[model samples]
Target: MAESQLLCMEDGLMPTAVPESRPQFYYSEQHRAALERLITGGDGAFKSLLKDENGQDFLSAREITAITSSFVKYKTDEENGGASAGQDKRDDAGSLHSTYWPQMSDTEVPPLDIGWPSSGLFKGVTRVAVHTHPPKDNGPHIKEVVRKLIQESSKVVAIVMDLLTDLQILRDLFEASKRGVPIYIVLDEPGAPHFLDMCNRLQVGARDLQNIRTRTVKGIGLNLSVGRIPGNVQSKYMLIDGDKVMFGTYSFSWSSSRMDRNMITVMSGQVVDFYDNDFRELYAISDKLDLFKQFHMTKPQTGTLSRAAVPKRPAAATSRFQVNLGDVTRGDGKVPAHKYHNPKYLLALGQIPGPTEPLQDFFNKMEPPDPETEQELENPTEELENLTPDPSPPEKKKSKKLKLSFKSKRGKKDKKSDEVIEENPANPSDEASKHTLTRDETQDSLKKKNTECMCVIA
Candidate 1:
């Protein structure tokens, strides 16, 4: 089919291509062998990642609450001597369980019961096995279960996922493809680029690509609309050989496997067909060429991909809207004086919050400093030095001169004499500074001053 025909239309929705017969879950000796393979022998890619620090996992939000509340309830019953076991105890916050998690949302919700099979919602998916992080009840690890499912699939494997960065899973899938098992993957449009990049890095050639068929969700994924907003393919599930299925919050990405506390439930029998139909529907809607086209669009080297692997914002791309003409003067683009400060004029706050009249810089500008004060302030150090009093003792005799000896260093041990003169108390800073000079320095300064005094005052 042409790639353009795959684009969802407003009126013409393509009918889903269904299998001739509903897939049958035949439990033969092969099923037991697969179970044995799952338990005993399998590839260790999943195990290799689990030991890394980034692979650490924890309980889901609701699970933590459930465990904590159960502990609290048991403790309360113990304290009441088993009398409060039958009585209801409500937590002060709201529900019977304490709010262990603040603003806690149940992202990994437990499978809800489907009205005991009579409500037309239940499917006989009884061969269920679950694995969570922390490995409860000596159950197999999450990665082990995923590896086993893919390892055991005898015929076809279809996976519809959002993200696929896990290399170990890719290796497992590659090995499965080598076993003549045709793999069909329908990925989300948003995350298609990363998966395509990974495939490039792994050196997957044309033949491998042909065997491992991959497609990305195209325009208006779930609904038709006149707007440009694209649909997000958020479904995460896998169908094994058309007869067994696995569905969960556990993403096919590394972060979901390692850092997250996600869970996957694998089932066999009647329910697999329902999920198989859903997978077929998803596969029918996805397009192979659209995946590559989007990859070229969202990749940096191929194109100008911005953060989040999307195009630059409309304002950022257009120079006209992105121009930052200041409030005082907007270059080239000038606003009429009448438009501003009038009923028609409205100032933008640069998209910042907390704008008010008192906080405006225009109304509260600082006044200019006095010119005389500005000049005086320039020589602040000299003024401060003048203001300080001399620490030396007062004169015993009726003389204004302050006599002081300063030792000077000159080649070994040569003595030097300094000239003295009458000192004015008004010029205390000059005399105070002179007190700090060494012998030779003091002598030179005093001699120069004496010569000047002798020449000018005589």
Candidate 2:
């Protein structure tokens, strides 16, 4: 005989019953064993049992969150060039790449035609200025850069701001002047700080022999800014020797040196001609230097020159650019204005010379890729292979399993019929209890019948 306790016999042995299938919890001893191995052999050895077969590092979010957080702080430090103090120590070796590296699409090295070398490979550029903002302390490097510019082509140098006689630039001006280099000095307004500085330096100081030969170009224009836009003020730009252009943002001053990121691109090429013509028009007005001295010193002038002068067009009429501005709303509730499209500029572009044929023809003639640039995306089949290692094809998730049950269909139908018959009361003949046995029960039944008979006769 089997034991009275519910014995779930399986495979000829009594097995303990269990609830619906679920994963078993690890015992305290098992957890301690794993932890001991981790402490003794380091995580790598202990991780073998816990890894999902492929040996990839499996770190919980909580374990690696602190490390990932440092990247954000590292990025912030690099953008401001360490200008901000109190950044994380880990990011001290910040990189400039996040800010300065140009995009592939935007990386166009325009041809250095008109004596401006636009080829991507240049040893580098040599830049000389009255003052190089983002100044370098290495005078040798400065000299080298200046020598290269001068040796390369017709080097035109400009004295931006007022030509201060006492400033160190005047020394350079003196040297270049003696060297017979055509240096153009473009001055700001007469009463401006630059204007006053030039006056004090020249009047209170001894006659610099260079001033006799130094040529001045009087300018009427706004300042230049780098990596920033001014509040609706247009800046004036000048081309020196058709090599580079200097566009001013702030009034050239001592305050502008280390305090601001103001700068000018020492660019080369046909671009230089664009700035050269601008200087020419301003120089054209300097012929009346007497009038400049008198009119600027508050003496009343009688001529049309007293009125604000309209700036001259830098490019010739056919090549002139027209600007189109658009308003873009930013996330901070500010509407930033930007250049949308310049139709006139597009018209000028249409005139630019391309390789002797239409754009379609040029594209059709392009050769196939130089295999070095072609990178293949991974194969989906290979990725699937790695994911599945069951030694057999996936079982299709058993979409709908069919099982053989011991209970017959007829048994189910009979059970359902029995339930319905019990729920509804059956006829007396079919009642399970057919009669009442006690005498007191029979007397009560007769009394109820007599009362009914009396009520019917009445």
Which candidate leads in TM-score? 1
Distance (Å) between predicted and true CA of 258, model 2? 2.2
List TM-score per model, in order. Answer: 0.36, 0.26
At residue 158, what lDDT does model 2 achieve?
53
Worst 10 residues of 1 by lDDT: 110-119
| Residue pairs of candidate 2 with colliding backbone atoms | 112-116, 112-118, 156-241, 223-248, 223-249, 224-248, 224-249, 225-249
Off by over 4 Å in 2: 1-155, 160-166, 191-238, 248-251, 290-458
Highest lDDT against the true fold, candidate = 1
**Scored by Cα lDDT, where does model 1 land?**
0.54
**After best superposition, candidate 2 residue 188: deviation in angstroms?**
2.1
Tens digits of per-residue lDDT, candidate 1, 1-458, equal 22323433336775343332545422223223332232233324323343442443233556434433322111354575754423444433345644484575444322211111122344565598777875789988787788888999877778888888788888888888777688778888778888877776776544344346677785442111211223466778888766677888888877887788988888877777688667666666566633334334332232465768666443212242332344323333433332333332335423222223332463355355434323333345633432222344554334434343333433234333333444334443573564444435645674554433322110
- Between which residue pairs do clashes occur in model 1? none
